[model samples]
Every structure is written in C-alpha cells, then in structure tokens.
Target: MSDLWLFSFMDDELREKIKIQSEQTKAVVYSKRTCLRHNFLIATSKSYTENSILAYVDNTEMRSAVKDIQVYHMGTDILVKWQINEVPCKSDTFRVQLLDYKYQQFAETQAKDTSTVLFNNTSPEGIYHVRISWDVYSTVRNLYTHAVGLENVNHGVPAVPHVTDLGNARARVRWTTNPHCTPDLIHVHFREPSSIGLLKVIPGTDETTVITGMKQCIQYAIQLGFSYTTGKEYLSDPAYMTFLSDGTFHNAPKLSFDQNGSLLVQWLLRPGCIVNQTVVTVETNDQPAKEYNVTGDQPLARLNDLEPCAFHTVYVTIQYKNGNVERTNSSEIHSFTKEIGLTKIKTYIVDDVLLAHWESTQNCQALGYRVDLMNPTTGQTKAYLTGEMKYRVSIGECVKSCQLLVSAISVDTMVPVTTLIDVRPERVPAQPRPPFVRRDGPALFVWWTEPNLDLTIQSYKLFVNDSKKMIRDFEVKQPRRSILLNNIEENVVYSLNLRAINESGESQPSLSVQYKWNG
Candidate 1:
C-alpha cells in the first residue's frame, strides 16, 4: 500500500494500522495533486472489492467573469458584445436580462454567441441596464452594462411628412420617426403663402396632426422637427402643400317644378373640387325636414309627392375626402299649386236656348269661366268667356242636340266641366196655308203648303166635314203641295182643316175651308 497522504502527519503506529487495513481490503491509495498536474489512481478487482478507496482533489476554479462588456445603439436595435478569457463549452449558454430605468427586469434571453442584438422599438427613450450571466462548474457568473445615455447618442431628424388637403380650410399632416432613435418632443411648423404673420407651431408626441382654419386654394410651407429631452432639436426637410377651401364654390340652387309636378333642384360645383357625396334638405311648414343623399357628380335632384299649395325651402351640402364638409346657399321659398275641376254643373233648355251653370269648389285662382257650345253632328264649336258662373247661348230651331263645356281657367292651369242638352224643336209645323180644291169626274184634288221647314214634322193630318156635319180624317206623310182625295160625293160641300204632327204631338188646326166637290 502506498503511504496515505492524509495520515502522513500521524505516528508510525497509526500509519501502519491504516496500511494493514488497506492491504487486507485490497484497496489502492491516491496522493494529493495540484490543479496544474494530473494524478491518476485506479483500483480494479474481480471479486470482493467492497473496500475500494476513491478520493478526489478539487483544483478547478470558477470561470473568469466576463470582461470588457460593451453595448451600442444600432438604429432600432441595441447591440451587446462581451469578451471572456476561455472558450465556452457546447453546453454553456449566456442569459441576457434587460432592466428598465427602475432597475426592474423586463426581458431575458438565452444565447450561445458572445454578441447579440436587442430590438427595443416599443421601449421608451431612456437608459436601460443589461445583465449577462453564465454558469461554469456549478458556479454562477454575471456582469452588467448600461445603454448609452441620450446625450451621447446621435439622432437624425424625422422623416419627410405627407400632407393631405381636406377641403373646408383643413389639412392633415403625417410622418414617421427613425427606427434607430427616439424623440422626446415633436414640433410642426406651418407657414402661409402670402403672409409671414400666419406662421404657426404645434407640439406633440404623436406622428400625425390636423390643421384647420386655413385660407382657400393657397400654398403653405410645412416642416417637422424631432427634439430630445436635452433640448436639442433636429429639423426635417421642408415640405410644401396647397389647401383648397370649398367656400367659394357654394351657391344657391335653382328651384322649379316639372310638368309631372316633380320638384327639380339644380346647383353648380366649384372648379377643381372633388366631392364624394351631396346632401339635400327640404323643409316645409308644419312638417319634418326631409333629407336626400345623391352622388356628387349629379347636379340635379327631383322630389315627388309633395303637398299642393304649400311653401318649401331647400338647401345643399357637399362632402369631400377626409371628412370635409361644404355648405351651399339656401333657395328662396317657392309655392306649389294644382288645378281642381269645377263642380255642381247643370244644363237646361228653354225657348230654344241652352243655359249652363257650375260652381267652383276648389281653392284655385281663376281668371274666368269659358263656355264652349259644341254641335257634335256638325263638328262645330263656339266658345264664350264670362266671369259669372252661369252662361246662356241661343240655339236655332233646327238644332237636335248640343254639348256645353264650362272650364275654369287660371294663369297657371285650367279645369273643365261638361254637360249635354237636347235642343231639337218640339213644336209642330205651322198650319198649312188654306187648301185649294178642284173638281174632277168622280174625284177631287187637294193641296197645301208648309210655312217653314224648321219643325221636324213627321206627318200632317187633315180633317174634312161634309155639308151634313159628318167628319172624316186623312193623313199625308209628305209636305207636297197637292194631294188627291178620291171617293167623294158629287156636288157636295166639304169643309177641310189641316194640322201638323211631330214627336211632341199635333199642333192647332188651321182655319176650316169650304169646298164643293163634283163627280
């Protein structure tokens, strides 16, 4: 057995006892070794090896702490680099933790490489502490590095801004910040084209802003700047824009009614202005206001089913891009009226004259009543104008039927009422003149003349009485002047009387005439 180094300080007797126990158990002894030296002690047996002595001496120290830790701000990302005295093993890994200004760890990551990049776009502009740690031989090693201060880091100006001209004296400006840098303050400058006194400044942390109350169709100079908490400001490139105001394009619309009673409204748009939608408002007395939406390209609009004889007012508004609004002028009040027909129409005939009467029941302004007498058979019409409700027209004796139309006419519209009347002469023809009688062998001839043809006489009736006071009647269908009377007694005195007949019945008989008949 080799000398036991642990018991080397003991007496020879104790050492000899330890050696005897070691030899009896078939055990091998190991000696102490330094960290720089390699000492090997191996014990092997096929059987009864329960007394084997195994020892170890620990000389390895904890891996040297990471040195020369460095951090850099690369645009939108932060880069961390470190150096170590020894190469890392395959199982070794670095754990990086980020602490905010409050010393609170907000993020941690594991990496096998010595260098890493940290993306901190969402973090605010402030100092951050980074801690790097590793495990070596069951011992923990850690180091820390701080982000560069805001004063030492260089920042560029904000990106060039985009300007949108929203009509109605308004504009929108938008920009983006550099991903590598953070700004504590944002300032916007606006300069009018014509006036130096119109310069304005707006300060905020947002990247977009809206400016209002600008002149119409004028050019403006705009610029943006980014500043740090250290009161250092960097300005971006200047930008130019022109904002258009719709005030000059707004005008009153023309109002009128079409033939079909639809209200038509028309308006004009300002030059060089683009509109997305047009809004029309219609208002009437004792009614709710009506709204209508139409495309901006169309300048005309029509409204139907409006109340008659009512006043209405109209106005228009236009909507442009970016929610800009323009209000136009309102139209004058307009009155609408419609024509209503006449009522209570009546017609009568008396003494060969036709009379027509009607009543105006509608609330309409009329100039006068026009009466038209029409002969349907002859296709002839005659008109008469009168202010009164009743009209009288003479009809000749030969008229059979007639139509009367009474119309109420106004400056704007006209309404007519019609009626028909029978104008045929109902009286019998005048009594025929005194009939002449002539004697013939066993025959007598009689003839008569009509006074006028105005009466529609269907037939004529003649009454004859002999000398003995006996009466006999005869009829003639024609108005011929001569009629033959046969089968009369010879040399007998006869009295003849004539009467005219028509649809209205017979007329009075003519005077009796005495005649002698010879056969």
Candidate 2:
C-alpha cells in the first residue's frame, strides 16, 4: 500500500528552505533551486524523515531567471529579444511589456514561444523601459528590465563624420554617437604610404580628433570603428577627407554705397578655410550682370562709374584650388544709387489746391519725389511724398504767397536732390464793370458783367444798402451775372454794389449805383 510522504529542499548558499507533500510508492521530487553552490533535499516517510544532499540531479534548471537581453533601435520603433540559457518546457509562458521613462506600461502581450517583441511608433527622442517575465512551474518570475534611448543602443547606422581642412597639410575630424553607447574603444583607420595605420582614442568629453602629416591639396580615405557594450565591434562606411580648402566662408558678404555714391563690396573669411580667389558680381534691371575677379588676400573691392539712380544687386563667390566654388549665404544685396536734382518744376493754383509738377529729364530711377510748400507769411510748411510726377496741396485763403521745393529721393539713400520755387498765382480776376438795376413786379434785379477772362472767376458777390447800412447780400456762382432782391418797400432809396471772386482774393467793388423801389 502507498503512503503519503513529505519532501523538503534547502539552499545552503541562500539559507532558504521549501517543502512539498507527495503520495506514491516510489517517491520523486523536483525542488526549485537558486543560483548557489550547495543545496540539500530531504525525504520523509510516515514514521521518519531522511535528510541528504541532492547530488545527481540539478534543480537549478527548473528555476527561471533572465540571462541575456539584446535591444535594437529601428527608427521610431524598438525591438527587444530575451534569450534563456536553458531549454524551455512545454508549459513555459512569456510576458513582454513596454514602459515609459516613469515605469508606466503602455503596451503588453503574452506568448508561449516568442523571444522577440517589437514596439512601433516609439519615437527616437523618447525614453522607454522594457520588461520581460516568464512562468516557471506555475510561478511568475521577472526576467529583465532595461532603459533604452538613442544614446544607449546601436539601433541603426552611426552618424557620418564631418571633416574640415585646417590648412598646412593638416585636417580635423569631428563626430558624435549615442551617449549611452559607452563604446569600448574608438579607432580611426587610414592607409599610409607603406602599411595600414590605426589611431585609438577614448570617447569622453573631447569631440574633435585632429589628424596631421597629410599631403596638402589631396584627398584620402578614412574609416571609424566602435565596439558595442556586448563585445561586438562595428565599422562605419568609408568617408573621404581632403586637405585642400573648399572655400568655406561663415559670413555673408556685405555691399554698401560710399559717401561718394560708389558701389563697395566687402567680405570676411573663416580662420582656417582658405580660398584661391574671389569673384564679385553686379546686376541691374536695364543691363546685364558684370563680374570682377579679385585675389583672395583682398577682402574689399570698389566699382566706380555705376549708373546714377539705378537699382543693382551685388553678390560674392569664392573658388578653391580644386575648382570647387561656393556662394555665401545671403550674400546678395539690392539697392538704388543716389539721384541728381529734379528739373523743369512748375507750380500753379487750381481752385483751393496748389498743384506742383516736374519733368523726369535725368531718367532717374528714384523711389519717389517729395514736395514741400511753406507759407512765408504764417511760417507754416506742409510736406508730401509721392511716386507720381505731380503733387497737390490746399492753399486757399490761408496762403496768398508761399515757397515750394521739389526733391528726388532714392529708397536706399534718403538724401534729397531738391529745386526751390516761389509760388504765386499768375493773376486774379479783374474788377467787374458798373452794375445796373431793374424792377420787375415787386422785386428789384441787380446785374453785372465780368470784364476779365484772363483768370478764372469763382463767384460774384452782390451787396445792397438802404442809404445808411448794408441790408442784404447774395453770392452768385460762376456763369451767373445777375441776382434778384426780394422784400422791396415802396418809395425807398437803395444803393447796390457787385464784386468778382477768384483764388487770390475778392476784387475791388464795382462803382455803386443808385436805385428806388416804387409801388
């Protein structure tokens, strides 16, 4: 008959013990063990229990633990693989989870036979944590947890190295890699005249690697090596480094006009980058572009005899000994040259507005013109800027005689080229002829004629008085020569007068006429 028996296991290294019960004629026990040196198993019958060391069978295989983990970067995705040293049993299950920088799980999945898991859309700039767990004999056990970033994993190809020419048969190379990479060693390889040469450098705060003893004005091949933390060495694609300068200029060329209105070109060069020659170009709307070549030592060039008041664009370019050419960024400038004085300027009066116009005799390409009208009597001036040929201002009765100045202005240069003018109305309407009066029904009529046609007559003024003071007044617009007087009393004496009006002022009153109203 089979009897119930008790089995116990003890880990001497960890000093931990566990017990299980079984009922069988031939007792067998698989006790879990930790990674330690010594472990003992004890079996007991109904009467007594026996203690002995587990010598033949290894129980540590049943205990699951994370062994090796490999992480790879795939752009915005991360791939993780966890490998276990021991063969997995049919009942083994695996769980994979992706966590954020704060250890919050965003995605999770479980499988029975998968060692690799992929998380997509995890941008390269993000910090992510990965967790893996497996079931060992119905017990959940965590395998590994790791933090991944761009600097941590050799996800893709390493960044390309940048080489700069430092002149005098010397060159400088610079590059950067993932910060967490912690490369075992950095190697720079080049083929020398007789054999292959390698330079070993340690990655740290220093970023620049300088290589000397190279031929000037020649090209050479270069390669870099990096050893991953997993003890695997990686080599980068071959890159070319040349000692000849490539006309690398950091600052754009500056273009300006001198005090004498001449075109001046100025530029600057980086400390180590040298060029064989520089070319300056000038272009205009009415003419083709012109180029000027200057030696590399000369930083400035002057161009004289440019068209007056012309719009021009100037730019600079540099060339290397190897025929490589490069233009400076934002090196071009567009501007207008200074202008000459305006000519054939004339001023006149139209109603209440003062009209001033000029002739573009010099064909100046100016942005516009400025007209200024100053009242000498009141000491007040009004200014106007316009692109048209003519400018107008209201003078009316406020300004009888004023001074005018017309100027040509360039948008690039605010300097004015002006011509002075004295503004005065050519003539005012002459005095009107003597007036006559007529009676029709109960109203009296007063009439007059304008004797001068040389000046424009704005209106006609009529005045009536009853022997002592003015009684009624009327203003008749142009083309009307008569006005009718109402409310006439019987047998009363009245005096009538008329005047002509123009832009200048009212003309002297016409000789008075005597009249009488009879009922």
Candidate 3:
C-alpha cells in the first residue's frame, strides 16, 4: 500500500460527504519518495479496477481558500463576488484588493458581513484578489484572483424598442443599445395575449429586424434584451403595439428586355402608404444575386451585363414606415437571355470545295449555323444556314478569294465568328505540260494540254523571244489552249515559253522550247 493521506477535498464534494449523499469516492495517494500527492474521483458504484485515470502529482499547496469567484466591470465600477469554503472567525474579516496585471495591489478593502465589494472609478483592465483577514501577518498569500477587462462590460439595459405593423403577418422591430455596452446578441421577446411567447434572436449589429408568422390584426407585447460578450444579460421594460397588417401591394411588376439585352423592371407600391426606399434583386443561374437600391418614387430599374444564355429571376422589396418591408404579391419574374456564342472555327479546302467547320458550344440552344460567304472581288455575300457542324461551298471563280463568317443561330441571337480563306490555287498552275511549238518562217504555233481545268486559272499566256531577249507575247483564254504568233523573226533561234494567269497573279514560266525559224 502507498503511503497516502487525504488532507482536503473540494467544497462541493466536502458538502456532499457531510450530508451523507456523496455519490463519488475520492482517493488520494502520497508518494513519500517524491514528496507529491495524486488525487482521483471515481463513481461510487464502479470498482477502482474498472476506472482509468492518469494523475500528475505536484508539490503545490491545497485548493484556494475561496470558491465560485467572479469578476465583472459594470459601468464605471469594478465588482468582485466570491464564496468562502469555511466559516471565518469573527476577527478574520474579508479583504478585497484590486491589482494590476503584474499582481501589484493598487486598492485594498476590509469588510465584515459581506462576500462582495465594488471599486468605484477604477481603471479599466486589472485583476481582483480576495482573501481572508486584512492584516499581512494573518495571511500567508492571496487565495483567489480573477482577470477582468472593461471592453466587454455591460452598462445598462437597452432602450424600449419601436415596432411597426406590416401587412402579411409581419412586424418590424427597431431598437437602440445603451451608451457603453456592446452586446453580442439582441433578443426580441414577443407574445400574443394569453399565449406562449416566442423569442427571436439576432446579431448585436442589427438595429432593425423583421418577425413573421404572427396572426394578423392582433396585439402583441414586445420587449428587447441584450447579451454581452462577458456572459452578462440585461432586459428592457415591455412595450405594447397592435399589429394592423392592413397595407398591401396593388400591382405586379412588368418585365422586358431592351435592345441591348438589359432587363427593364417596373413595379408599383401601395397608394396611401409612404415608402422609404425600393430594392430590386436580380438572381441568375449559378451566380450571386445582385441588388439595386432606388428612391421610393422610381418604379423602374435596368439591370445590365447579365450572363448570356441563362435564366434570371427578378423581384422587388419595398421599405416603408419605421423600417418595415413589404414584398410585392406577384414578385417573381422569370426571363432568359440569348444563346452563347460559337467556338473556334477552322477552314480547309479539298478538290475545289471549301469546307468550314466549328465546335458546338455547351448549353447553347442553337437551331442551326449560318455560313455567309463574301466575295472580295465582286463584293457579293451569300448566306447559307445548315444544321450540321460543317458547311461546304464549291470553290468557284467568283468566290475563289472570299471571307467566311460563321454564326450560331438561335431564336433571338446570331453572333458570328469570322475567318478568311483563299481557295484560289496559291501554287502557280502546275507548270503546264511542256509546251509544244512548230515554226513556219517568222511565225509559230504553240499548244499545250490544259492543267486539270483549274477554276483558279483565268487564262494562259505564251512568250516568244530571240536568243538575246523576249520579242513578243500572246494571250489566250480558256478552252483555246493554242496560240498563233505571226511576228517572229526568220532564221533566228527563238525561246518560247507559256504560263497560266488568274486573280492570284501569274504562274511560273513553263519549260522553254527552242524553235529556229528559217523561211
């Protein structure tokens, strides 16, 4: 067995043991080797082998001489309250002292027949120390101390609140806090006559709030209270108000979209009641709602820059007398924006046909795609609509060089994505099959096979030149691949070459053919 002695027990446990009602058993173990004591409190019904407890032993003194000590700052006074664990001797009065954070006493008091004391006009942040006996010789050390800060003190109760009746089973409440107390919560206690009351709690920062779900045309008793950060509570006197709930909205809001896609909303208010302000809330899919506040006289609000291809919900809230809010009867107005735009577009050519393709966007309600081809040469534009993702146009002479504008067409919108493509053969007509030449005394006949009848080729050209320089040239149109030259010199070795020509400039000269003309 360990050498142990139970020197003292906590106040509550000691009281329970004295009354023979202690449902817990406490065991104290003293380690004579280490000069430390370990204490444990276990359920009286449970065996010591069934409970687990790890206790650290220290050589410190026993529990403080006082229990249930609380420190508070109310208004300009610092208040300390405590309970003694044992009855004091008549000569051993209570001593209360106010100390700084460093535990240096600044104010001290001796009182008999009192368990609490107040220090008037003291500084804000400090600690309070209380112990038995006023003389230093009678006390060994301070028994209990508590830290208090003036920042969270409760000064006084909140002023009586003002209540207003709003139609549709609602009432607005407004209140003001005392000068020095900053509460953490505001409680609005309201009760209908002869019925159980309900309490609504709101944040301390709110001076105005609304309570709903009450019976109309009934009188209610309303009161306000505050709860501070220091766990202190204060309540105000009750005030009476009758809920009339007679006001109502007369007209529903009208909604429309302008040409620029801005939402135009118009609403009306009750005729006789004076209004404070109007608030319009616009909510869109997957986005935070936006609010617009306007004067009471203005009934219209235009919301701009909304998401395209999304649904929007609009509503109006009216603020009237004594911060009361009333919502319109036909509140919700639903509308949709235009479809989204098209994605990246790509253009390619295959065998005299121009093909334009693009990606279809998600969440877009497009009926079809519109492909518009504009001829840069003739300045003519042709529009074609197709439901497929790709569109093909035959590369003709008129549209060899054109700009294509592709747009996704929906019920209400058509936004275009444009790209330029040159269908005209960029490589000069494949060097025409070696030109054939025959000379007849100062004249020559040249002919060659047409190169695949390319649409990019407008015509052909033949060059006749002497060994020194080019002498003459002849032009030939399509379908007449041969040209006759009459102005060639006789007995001269001439170099003859041919080339193809179109809107995209000229092709490289074909292989030169030598023909000596001797007449």
- List ranges where model 1 is wrong by over 4 Å: 1-247, 258-261, 321-323, 336-519
> What Cα-based lDDT does every candidate model obtain?
0.62, 0.63, 0.63
Best by lDDT: 2
lDDT of 3 by residue, 1-519 (tens): 222222222221221111113433554343332212333433233333343343333343454445676555555655566666552322246777766655577777776766666666674553334333332123233344454432435445577788877866787888876543455677888877658565656665568888887664345788887765445566677777645446343556788878665778998755545678888877787689988888647788887766656767777888765445666644444444334644677665544556677865433477778888777888888889899889988656453466777877778878664444444544446566668988655567788987477877778888777876757778898868887778777677888788787654566677888888766
- Give the range where candidate 1 is weakest over 10 consecutive residues by summed lDDT: 8-17
Residue-level lDDT of model 1, residues 1-519, one tens digit each, is 443322221111122113333335344444342222222233333221343444333344445546565554434544455665553332246777777777687777776754553535434457767777665434322433344333223244566678887667877888886554555567777777455422233444466888888765455777876655435566678787656545334489899888566789898865566678898898887799888888647789988756555678889887764345666788855553454544677655444565666755333466778887778788888889998889878766335666667777778776775444444444434555677777666677877776566447777778889988899888888645567788788678999988777654456578888887544
- Pairs in clash, predicted candidate 3: none
Clashing pairs in 2: 151-178
Candidate with the larger lDDT of 2 and 3: 2
Among these predictions, the greatest TM-score belongs to 2
* Tens-digit per-residue lDDT, 1-519, candidate 2: 333333333432323344444533344544354432343444444332344334433333454455466566644555666666564332246677777777777778775666666666664446766677665443333344453442334453355567777766666777776653345577777654345768778878576698878764344677777754444455667677645433243667787877655678887754445578888887776698888888656779988756654667777787755544656654444444234643676655645567776765344556688788788888888888898878878776444577778777765655445556666654545667878899978898878765557447889888788865657778999787888888887778898877777765566677888888766
Cα TM-score per model: 0.27, 0.34, 0.30
lDDT of 3: 0.63
RMSD of each: 22.4, 18.0, 23.4
